[model samples]
Target: MNKNFIIKKNREGKKEDVPKKIFFKTNLFYKEKGFLKFFIYSPIVKEYAFYTLFPNGLNLFIYDKNTYNKYTYLRADWVKSIDKMFFHIKGNIIIMSHKGVSLKTEEIFWDRRKKKIFNKKYTKIIFHSKKMILYAINGIEASEDLKKIRLKNINGTFPVK
Candidate 1:
């Protein structure tokens, strides 16, 4: 039996189109300049003609180049990659950095080549060190590590230190 091709009948009892590829319990690692940059794990992945889908969600760990230590982590309930560099992520998106910053949103677009993440939906950012919570009403743009961030139309309370 071919793992990629699974026979499934539709409501009319006709066979559906099988995915080009399917991966189960897979880990993908990306390296840059002989240094580990990203590690992605997904329980299931399906590849079609135009895109790859992570239906069961995925965890992405980003490592520092010099130290090779994980500096950021991202999780999403659903992800679709149209190409190698660009990804559309949605459903309970959470991003955390080792610098004590966390971001929560419903959807986001990630550009791996540019090392940028952005969204046009509501976003909540928390600074653990400052004990402050920020809300972005219009959207947010930030680096992958959440180091340099820009929030638009924001209104939130900051604890006075």
Candidate 2:
């Protein structure tokens, strides 16, 4: 797996090996067998990413990044209809989806492990090629493609200074 496709926490502040550009989104979240599973959709790159976050580690599976467009066109159902898209990041050959999903590397190494639903506060989130960040507090999903630009409420894009 490519390190650039992962963002993990270590002894240091944080380790995010991402590409120069990114597009990401996460619609469904659940826990299973000591791993957090995420179903993500990327409108820009038109790719679907499945993430499995283990205690202190991250695993990502992108469904045909190079040739997803063709597949999506053939199988529209592959891109599940999302009522609420938390966040999907993709760019520079990497994509990430976060739906109230947050965890530290040390948390994965806990002696006692448990499974629970995600409890983040935010709603809609979408990243565009490290150029813009989009999110909503009231929890809203996009009905159409969004443009990358600075917004008043949404935080700036990733790789911030």
User: Alpha carbon lDDT of residue 98, candidate 2?
Assistant: 25
Model 1 per-residue lDDT tens digits across residues 70-151? 5689999999997768999999999999899999999999998998999999999999999999999989999878999999
Residues 17-87, candidate 2: write the lDDT tens digits: 33334344434334455454333333322222332221111233322233322211111112221222322
Query: Looking at candidate 1, what is the lDDT of residue 65?
Result: 63
RMSD of candidate 1 to true structure, Å: 3.7
Number of the predicted model whose lDDT against the real structure is largest: 1
Worst 10 residues of 2 by lDDT: 103-112
**For every candidate, C-alpha RMSD to the true structure in Å:** 3.7, 16.9
133 in model 2: Cα distance from truth in Å?
2.3
Candidate-wise lDDT, in order = 0.89, 0.28
Query: Clashing pairs in model 1?
Result: none
- TM-score to native of every candidate shown: 0.84, 0.21
